[model samples]
Target chain A: MSPRQKRQLSLEVNGEPYELLVEPHWLLVDVLRDQLHLTGTKIGCGIGVCGACTVLVDGQAVSSCLALAVDAHGKAVTTIEGLAREGRLHPIQQAFIACGGFQCGFCTPGMIMGAKELLDRNPAPTEEEIRAGLSGNLCRCTGYVKIIESVQVAVRLLQEEMAGEAGAPVSPGPGRHAAVGSGQGGAR
Target chain B: MALWPFDYLEPTSPEECFALMAEHGSEAKLLAGGTALMQFLKQGLARPRALINLKRLPGLGGIEVGPEGALRLGALATHRRIEDAPLVRERWPMLAEMLQLVASPRIRNMATIGGNLCHGDANEDPPPLLLALDASVRVISRVGERLLPVDGLFTDFYETALKPGELLAEVRVPPLPPRSGAVYLKFAPKSRQDFATVGAAAFVRLADAGRCVELRLGLAGVAPTPVRARKVEAALQGQLLSEPLVREAAALVEDEIDPVGDIRGSAGYKREMAKLFLRRAVAEALRRAGAAGPGPT
Candidate 1:
């Protein structure tokens, strides 16, 4: 087959702007991992079925494996590496770590990214909604029991944090797990 | 494996899209949302010389009410949007419900209704419901435009009636008449995200005193294309809504469907479930219609 022409793509990943030339066949996951060296995003199935390569395109979760890099032009792309704040882990990430959401850790990044989208949209999603939200992300390790709990914990952490920032009273609700601190080093 | 290399074209308008299609002819494929097209590209099932991404095209990504009070869904509207659209949820709950049941939430976020129909995948959930609702698609080319019923849209597996350069612009679903109800039911033996073993959609219009005025039933995953169970409809229409009548009518679906054995189920099992689901869908539709209040005088 003849060589494919490369297209220049300009995208906002996390808060950083990236301008790169990529082949039309280069998937977003490849560009993120191979070219940019942001390897937090994992690829399980090259097809869209597996959510291991889930990323946020303009705040909506999408499978990077199925998306061409050229399609990310002028769009804000958020991978697993972008989830944390200046130095603190995102509440979803903290919740996963605290709740034992992963075993092999292969699907953690994608699961956390999917959870981020879920919490961003529905701060306090029901268990059924959480399952529906994370249905795309397969967890061969945890059997998804702890992953579901992690989302619930994340919801409480986020709600408490939001309430704290607003100077509102934080009454401890029943069955609310204590907030987990970010023990890991500053965001990668 | 990496996708086969291909040139990507971003068209800002329908005319430009048509121009690209005209130039590339059968060598180009339109990309909307890329949920289906991307899979085909990566699996080497489709290696188009050019991919025309429709995201840049304006005026093709909204849900609105047309002049006749019909729901007009722009071709590029995502499945998630349809599932969450307030107008869709309130007016056509069945459509919204079915949309929610299509793949996972993330896939729904990226899959477009237009691409779903054009892909012509027989196992999808939307086509059967659309067919039962008498939905039609608006297709346009450089030459002219035409409206084709959803029933005739799918010619065969992965094949649509759209000719070269013809693009599906919008899907129009007529507003349900008074005392009418529609329901979509799918039997997935595997995970919830898996495609249905036998999917059934039924729309029933009831007159005064609970008499069936009109009925339509559409089945999926049991045929080469989404099929309307005309025999079932004929049996149920004009009959008094009753349990026995619905059961008898739904049994006709077994004869109308041509199911293929697959991992989901054997052909015989699917055919049996098709009849059962059809019965349940028709009965549920009647119940919903009765609860919807009395028909027009």
Candidate 2:
């Protein structure tokens, strides 16, 4: 039996569907970390200012701490844990490690998620654009130099991955690598 | 950091939402994009009994231009959506550019422009710009709908002119004035996402050999509500514009604002910044207006 004032939440997280009976006030971060055991999403500052609890809801990066569990209903949610597929790390995650994006690692997940959103929209973002895209997420360590570098590395990695795969829908079209970090890619 | 338990209700239609608003009265909070409200809830600042989610309602998420060329932003349209709308970029490029810097990309992806105005913070960027643009919000209730000018929307700190049951349904921005140039200046000493230490927006329309046909100014971070810098505007209107002339008029901005000392800056510093920024905003606006020499009809 559902507890009093608890609502059932149905959402897809990390390619897995979850049906949760959550208190109406329960935040999406709490549910993902507690009930669903997806603790990769961290909570740095409880307020929305910190992107520590960032998650992609419907492919848009949003603060999970600020989102009600019920708001995730019928939406596809992606957390930090979702970046790896079939034991292969996503390009962003790989770039973060390769470039030393984080020292404490608390902000890495949110940073990667924010970068994912940025690269998805604009595969090759300028340094300024990359900074603007992930401005919402903050890192108290390393002064953001390596963090920015990580995103740039991710951009090159993603371009190489897409270029290697032919017939992939939405590949940044021909001569995309020429533009590099200065302009738009091929498709989307 | 726990939020108070509440009923989360999604109404499929405006009528149902209105009824829920009426039934719950003060206890029901409308959720558009809950960027600010969620902050309030998690902080124990708000304890509403129910949250009426407005996402299911149709026609409230579109950004369209009417035959008159006015831009209509649906209440549920997120800031990111409005910023990305090709029509907004084509018509109101300055506004599109401004939206790119509101909070951050993630926050913009979730915060509705309607909700941003409704949150009624005096230090926000959009209010001053909206005031300069002569925007109006359409408030809908079960009884009827009415348009309220942006100037008259914010009544007090952390408050708006909206009544308990009235929902702000849309923001209507008139087409950019003919041959007009606009600029929004913000003084955020801290991060780019922080509230403006002081901000100003101006619109200048040049007519007949660079004489100022019309000039308007709006300011924030210096008052309980976004202000129309009338004294400054009055000083410059119909005058042949010059740097000294603009500077002299902008000095009157000190009288237009009542800034409170906060983390942003002291009241005295804000007043001086207000004058400085107002002068810069007007000058930049004039430069832009002059560049559009032939003037668009």
Candidate 3:
């Protein structure tokens, strides 16, 4: 009978603290895209069936469309826009580009976010684990072969970075060398 | 599309939650993981005047083993937690395996077990397995707390037996009986994320002579609510384990189910698959029990 009231939400996004008044019914994806202007998080099949709205809430991949902005009041939220740091892309992002993981780019952000969470938990996941981790994300293009390869390449790049072999900014150019990409030629 | 506007209430304790529920009653919807409720809200299926957020409720989220070796799963435990929990995996691997097959990694991370149960969706994977395992849920309100068997939790389509002001706090799963085994088999012809056309779970305890000492069967997606196939169980219980006996008992599942036609399958198709899965689940459970060694008494 009464009008819905906005609630105060205080949370951290991309390492920045924010305090805003949001409607109680506003989904986290809307708040991220509209309120914060972080449109990198895409919303597909808003009913949580599609993983196009994946984001990290407290380092765990969750469907932002299913989470109310109020539910994220005290948590650290990471959108796909936050994956890069200091003008350099995250390894997963670089891997997605190098491995041709995206064709339409509609599902790329969510796929990369999901892959980030997967690698964060299990740095060196097997192929089956990679597929299982990205099972929630559906890519209408690329047929998932390159997406799986991208995650595998990301793992090797991360392992190389950890070993201090290639600390330089990973070039997004073609023919960039990946340890795992060596033996599998023309697969990209 | 935006969700319909609603006021929000965040209650930090069970007493506060119960008070809010008592005041708001049917006008309020309690939110745990928000995976199921959020979809309902977005689709205009539910228009609660107030959304009660239960994230801050203390002692409502955790997995612990009770003194008697029973597993106590807090209502707020996510499917991801259940799938990865060492205690659940070691004690009730069937439950963990079932949880692993739910939706996907993201949905599993966001969907809570309590919310899943309270949603009372027959297409879900956990209810039938929980029913077959003889699990019970603890429902608490300001007045008192009571235990309801998981089999009795679902009353109808998208309806639960939880009364107004009553909240499901935790699920208590009894430890598997000695020489007993359980299996949950889901038949999803579509993608892995799709709901099962006919999901079946079976628990069997074998006697030393390979006779079935006990058998419990539960099915989902073939009825308005998850149901225990009592007729099938009765046919198999205390009988000598055999291929023909299992097949005959499983065939009784067709008569026990009341399926509805949907995109997954026709009612008749689901009924047939229910019988097929029931047979496989019972046979696998019997084989596993035999491998577990001598039965208790």
Candidate 4:
């Protein structure tokens, strides 16, 4: 074992910038928990296998435990705590709560972050796509029934909000445009 | 709970990283995405005195097509980038699909292509696909640079041809000919957080006359390393992609692989699954080829 070395790093979390002295040995998950005191991101495997430590790095879900705090310099990160804005939960969080997407809640943060990416790129996704999107995350409590239902609920809520704002859109529903425009959509 | 202490050097230049590698030799390791390396460190499988972080190194992350139609996959290009790249999706959608099958969404966002290849896990889905695509891995050292075929890149399970002081630059996959289709299939138990029991990738080329002109079959997780099934290819060469021929080719994987029993599967079961995956992968590739504007005959 060797003494930990400190490094100067800057990171943006939940739309707020923080500059801190982090050890080279410090994992992003640890920094978020111990230093920043945002303990929403839980640690399960410590390795990348379990998605329990998932967080959004630049709007993409990543395992915080595998990420070095130094590697996150000059990047945008969002922990589970960042999802609620001004005491109002993000749509996904609300959907999770409404749909009962968690059981023991140990895997809820990672699952929410994973589904958040899917909804960001695709507000409406098929069950297969939803399964693929959340495949990395493992949940022993709910058997993924409520989790899938949670994403569906989020999609419906987002579509209803969009349709209400757009003032009655086409037959495909709001934000339901085919991925044919960008060719990013896969499967039905 | 956290990474062990080591001198971290985020070299802004590849030359600087390479020079540091040459100086530290085996005492150093390149940090791509840290998905695999970090796991290895936590498992006590790897520890080094220096980590040559490659993210800061210039020209290390990006995917582009070369003038010659080869797909240029940078070492630092994350799987998420590859999965989302329009170029990769347009030309080689199978690669994108393979990327999607690797780990979970969180892992894909941070796992680099170089890190996946260098991780040297026989169960990884990318190597078999890269091997089927006839991809080449570019390795850079302070001494010089060299490119090796994907099949030749792996020396053993958790071992690669990468020298101690060398860094993988990129994975270059040659363009497939027209009227070609490739598919990678893995038999991971539940399709979530499971290592592949048997993974097979098939790249098939149909002739203008409607016969099988060329075939490249690659398999992973059943052996010490991912292997190209030249035996199966030889059996199918010039043969009509008849159901009979495909069955014969599928049976050949059982003969060629030297599988090891593991928790995921017994050696016998892996051989069985390899045969199964080979058949499905070939049929899927052929079906895709046929669907691509009625290939040949």
Top candidate by DockQ: 3
Note the Cα lDDT for every prediction shown.
0.87, 0.85, 0.88, 0.84
Fraction of native contacts, model 1: 0.80
- Interface RMSD for each candidate model? 1.1, 1.1, 0.9, 1.3
TM-score-superior candidate, 2 or 4: 2
TM-score of 1: 0.94
DockQ of 4: 0.64
True contacts kept of 3: 0.85
Considering the two chains of model 2, state its CAPRI-style docking category: medium
Task: In angstroms, give how far residue A21 of model 3 lies from its true place.
Answer: 1.2
RMSD of 2: 5.0
Among the candidates, what TM-score does chain A have in each?
Answer: 0.89, 0.86, 0.89, 0.85
lDDT of each residue in B160-268, candidate 3, tens digit only: 9998889999999999988899999989878888899999998988777777888889898999999999999998788886777777777888777899999999999
lDDT of 1 by residue, B1-297 (tens): 588778889989788888889899989989999988988887788889988999999999889999899999999999999889999999988999999888877799899999999999999999999999999999999999999999899998788999987999999999999999899998997887889998999898888877889888998899998899999899878888667766777788878888999999999999889988888888778778874322211
How does model 4 score by TM-score? 0.91
Error of 4 at B133 (Å): 1.3
lDDT string, candidate 4, B170-279, tens digits: 99999978888899997888556577888999988888876888788999898888888888889888878877677877787777899999888899998888888887
lDDT of 2: 0.85
Better of 2 and 4 by lDDT: 2
Provide the interface RMSD of candidate 4 in angstroms, 1 decimal place: 1.3
lDDT of 1 by residue, A51-161 (tens): 999999999999999888998999999999998887778778878888777999999999999999888888889999999888788888888888887888788778777
TM-score of each: 0.94, 0.93, 0.95, 0.91
